[model samples]
Target: MTNTKTNYLFFTGKGGVGKTSLACATAVEMVDAGKVVLLVSTDPASNLKDVLESPVDENIKAIKGTNNLFAINIDPENSAEEYRNRVTQPLEGVASKGEIKKVREDLSGACTTEIASFDEFSRFVSGETEGTEFDVIVFDTAPTGHTLRLLELPAAWSSFTEENPEGASCLGPTSALKSGKERYHTVVNRLRDGSLTSFYIVARADKASLKEASRTSNELKELGMGNQQLYINGVFKAIDKQDSLANEIEAKGSEQLKSIPGNLNELPIRTFPLLPYNILGIDKLRSLFNPDLQKSISESTVAQTNTPHQELTGIEKLAEELCENQQHGLIMTMGKGGVGKTIAASAIAVLLAKKGHEVLLTTTDPAAHIQDFIQQLGELPATLQVERIDPKVETQRYTEKVLEHKGQGQSEEAKKLILEDLKSPCTEEVAVFHAFSKAISMAKRKFVIMDTAPTGHTLLLLDTAGSYHRDIMRNNMNAGRLRTPYMSLQDQELSKIILVSLPETTPMREAGSLQDDLKRAGIKPYAWLINQSLTLLSSITDPLLKSRASAEAEVINTIKTSYSEKTFGIPFIADTRLLPTLLGNKEKV
Candidate 1:
């Protein structure tokens, strides 16, 4: 890919598949190949600066001590503010302040930020940057859901503009839409043209990430971007074949590969072996494509000795603490994608159900598989019910409710406009927020174990909660007597937030950032759960796997000291088909 002449390249897949690392490595490789390259990150939760070890912002800043390489981080918050000004600035003096305020409020959403970032993305692809000196442009996109939405917008916006010339939905006025239509259409064509663009789907050897990569593959191909390639990252290699757990890890990767989704079979596929140590700095980045370099890269990561399992609390103890002799409460497991939030929530839900508590295991993720995951246990307890707040189902329900109540007195033409406006993707936010708010209310009667969507979407839901709280305070006559969902989140007695993450460099940092965001919202996390740590394999004979666990020690200690009041670790278990044995055994705190 570094040697390809393709003008545009995009790295997208499930989160934690090493998308950022791979993208940066590609840029470095291209530069080494003497090709001037520009990299752009469209993820709202971007970590380009951390990966590059360079001070990157909205501007195209050159990497330190490097030539012919430049990068940009399209900050969504800043982009939304700029887009809001662009939209409202024109309406000034010609429109009422009340009308302008309403428009601003409408634009204050995660969806708007998505569209704004899409607009910036199109600017580069639609010939607006044709005269730039760079030879190629590479994009490191957000997780699967967000990337699909971003790619779909060009076609969505083009069709929307052509049909609804007199009206606009979140892309500013009709006049601007008319002007952007051609560019949007141009972007759609550019994406479809195989010679000009390539979409790389990065994944791990796990079923979930591979399944998502397959879905992303078909979705992007349907959007006219069929020049797709699949990269299976972090392939397991057991140094000690005699070790049972290590061989199981290697066997699982092989099994997953043999049955990879059908769609992936059609694309060009590549694989990278897993590294026991985290890759940082430009030198380690180069080691990705060079296995010889990787072997001799560092000896510091390895320890000369083995140690027994260290003393610490586990998930069983944490689950007990969450129940705390209470029947009704809200327990939220929040984290970035691929961090085992669902598993943590499930273990706790089963533990509580066995203890005679009525629990509802739910998820707000659009790509959720809560029911399937729970049903795998063969016979679920009657006390433990599983549900997923299906975004599509909730959106349809919310749309009908709106059309029935708000559209009843309007004319057919007026109703048509309202329905058209509802087609905007932003409607998903309002629909999901309604369901989220209801779930919070249900916790008052039964244990509501919510495995929330990834970090970006959860923050958006929280932002909506805060917005709704402010609206109620400003407009309601009985504000002092009312308690909103935001208030429920802030109440320590009613709600408990558990931060979840893998014991790795990126996941740990992202979890810490999430904790800070929660603190800013006055929602202190009850505890931190480091999922999939190597602590369970403390007795393993493999040197590479042991070193992996050694790296986790530093991160685990950091979480205990710097982030959470209480910390727990869920060890890596090879057999995920069966429920955890720890469920039946509660630990003493």
Candidate 2:
């Protein structure tokens, strides 16, 4: 591994695919080779500090295990606050104090948060900020969709600036329109000229993740930001004869790897063996990072076999519970971004639709991949109606409506401030609540299946539901336009929550948190689906995968006992593409 370069490396994939761990390992490797490295995590629930076993806050701090390695967690909210203050500082002379307060509140929305985070990230990646002297910078990103959206912000911001160049520096829309263009352009130019930037799409050997990785690469290439590599993390082949579970996992993983999507076949692919112990802290990670350990693990994994077929008893039981209440029910799949929640949600929707139920599949995830999967299904029984709830569009419309209603005879300044407020992170909550409410209403008519936002956002959205409902009730009583038709869809009986996760620590922990959040919202999950497990299939001889595969059994059982009346496990497929045959025309399974 060469360590003389100052390239910016970003690791992203489906959630729980070991992106953070791999990023950490890479950073460690670089630091070990006498290079200064900065490891950053943009994910809200980033476990970077935990993995490094160091106390990492928003600022950079030296990592314990290495001399030149440092870690940082970029908090978007803080950055957004700073950005808001900067934008509003110049506006104090042009607008009244009250107007300035309103402008600040409005600028505090989700859009600003996203932009602020991107701004910080760009600074680091382009070496325009401090720590530029580091030999390498590695970023552990959120899921694929969120990361892509975050990366695309500079382009979006550029458009915003072009449309309202003069308003960019001011507190409201007019000022944002006037001065925003220059700020956006500066960031864009920095990104385009950054020759040291590199992106690594991390993925498991499963069909869904591999396909996602290929699609992500294609999307980035189209965007003219295609300096990339492919890292297939956690490739399990098999282990000792006594470990039947290990053998089965390796066999399944090998089958899937061989059938990787055609689009990703040519990319530089690196494989990391599944380690025996959890890759939590620096000590354990260092052991896995050792070249000798990797080689030994690889050899041992390749020499074992005798895997067993996994039981789908949990899924069957869950299906029975779902079918038990023939009454119209709603099942929602929710978690952090890029955790395969959409895939899992679609699987459940398809499974139910095949069972001859009137199923309506809907998603509030900004990056809805379900449509692609559905189209790939070719002709299906029209029993399933898939709809996507776009937060950006919905929020924009809602903001326009609010301005129209509240600023009927106000000055352009007031209207602009209202529009700015509409861009805040809170606006997404309002917009999502509208979509979610509409979805919940549908539960009264047909079986509703939903794919929700990631954990933090989802919780915030749910929390807003109660306040929203109260606000709507009060407004209706006072003769204001009734609440949007979508805000009242939170009935417990009509909704069944399904937490989707992998049989790994991070995802499982996140899934558990999701369950807790839902319960706090007076919503209880109907079941938990553990996606892409190798333990359920036949055994193989790869020691690396064997150990990892065996480890999944305990996690699976834990999920089965903790979540619901039943738990489901979807085995890792041989190919990333779901052939027409597997989608099954009859759908009784």
Candidate 3:
């Protein structure tokens, strides 16, 4: 039954939901069953190679052991380079060098990166894979927000091309779209055809993740990719009934499963149990396909557990430092999606607020659940307030502001074009960044804590900041105006970037990449936070839990040694129903 739907499988959801793992496991299973499989990862920050323990680069390569399995990682920058050449190669004879150079520069922006990546993946979706020989293609896509934008591109670009056939828009001349019309249309049709494609909305058994999954499911249905399934990953079920924390996590997972959204009830659902150790390498990944393999592995891992433990500094310690020093500045917690940045941010804000500091906590994350969690806490903190820099609201506000001021003397036709251009996704990034700048400006008065969007989008926002700094510097030729927002971020005394991540390889790898990106943008992170360290938990009898606890000792040690002065390890809590309690001293592990 699943074979017919195996031709094209798309695993998408919020970041850190184990989409890549599940996709790879499924592909490995198909390969073991003698079916040809091609696994393609379209995420710009892809960890496909790390997950597979093999090199999967821009060009497709065969898996080490599997004769019929192959994989590829689409490089967006390379794609943009190729895409630019395709658009400007023919103009060399007709246009001057400067003209060609300008065209290339225009194509080198974020918008072009997105379209180029889309163009590369569109070929596979359209069944235009010239060299690959495979029966099934599995796509491990980017995070939810980015994936939705990518999915919408075929129709969005198709409409723009149809309307402007010969006119130039964001991506250079409209003639560029002429050659790709049929291909884009084909990709659109193939995506909508239920028989040819299937999407599995992957999520965890938590309120925030489930809610995001439900929303994504509805949106996918709207896009006509209605043939869908749901996979609930990282479900924690207690092996020792007496273990209160494990039981609490188990009960919460069960409750969330029972309350599954009505819209998703009709779709088939699969649940994967949370493991004690990270699922890395071929043997561990293959264990996902065969449940019986888990127990033996768990037993072996638990038996090998022998690590010394020492007291680790946690968020409470950091809170003490902040309170003692009366720290007041911009506090930013950032990492890949689903890595518990929201929880970390909330904890910090709650701690500071309890210390009677005026803290304004906010987020720019699309899958934000801060308000929902705060509501669950029953009451608001007197010293703390929460707000979200909503992209849609900010974009609308920005558009109206522009129309009222810049569009004042324009003709109706000119005004209409301005409105249309404002609707582009690029405008939302700028608007959100504008809001971010405003938030940074508020740090002079009180503590400003910002929970940023996931890694990819956050990088884009920072890139916008970098570009804006260059533009303003070029125009003003003075550092006076730049001293406000631009210099504010670079000032360590005025701003602190807190990098958060799980102890697992993927999140840490991405966190390292995120740190590098921030450094490149001239923003240095003040600290590294290792969230949900099982090493901090009490002695565990359950084999799985014990094994997990043992594995975390090594990770925690690495963070402590490498970032001893600045690293903080936050233990995993059993219950998070009350934010205050969860982040309070009473619950300190």
Best by lDDT: 1
- Tens-digit lDDT track for model 3 on 1-589? 2365547899999899999999998888888888889999988889988888888999989888666889999988788778788889889899999788767765655677777788889888877787857889999998998888889888877776666565444476655533567888888888888888889899988877888899999998888888899999999878888777777878888988888888878889989989866777778888886878977787777779764554567787776665566557888898888787888888888878878899999998888877876776666679998999998899889989988887898999988877766655556766887899999988888889899888877776665666566656645856664565767888888888888888777887788888887787788888888887767766656656777777777766666676435888777765657465566643456
- What digit string (tens of lDDT, one per residue) describes model 2 on residues 156-216? 6666555554443222443422234555666566445436667789898876678789888
Off by over 4 Å in 2: 77-109, 126-133, 165-186, 239-267, 287-289, 295-313, 323-326, 336-340, 354-356, 366-382, 387-437, 453-490, 516-526, 533-546, 553-589
Looking at candidate 1, the ten consecutive residues that score lowest on lDDT are 580-589
Residue ranges of candidate 1 with Cα displaced over 4 Å: 91-102, 129-132, 166-179, 298-300, 303-309, 409-411, 581-589
Cα RMSD of all models vs. native, in order, equals 2.4, 6.1, 2.6
Local distance difference test, each candidate: 0.82, 0.68, 0.79
On lDDT, who's better, 2 or 3? 3
Error of 1 at 89 (Å): 2.4
Candidate scoring better on lDDT of 1 and 3 = 1
TM-score of model 1 vs. true structure: 0.94
- In Å, residue 520's CA in model 2 sits off its true spot by 5.6
Which residue pairs in candidate 1 have backbone atoms (N, alpha carbon, C) closer than 3 angstroms, thus clashing? none
Per-residue lDDT for 59-102 in model 1, tens only? 88888756788999888777778888888888999999988987
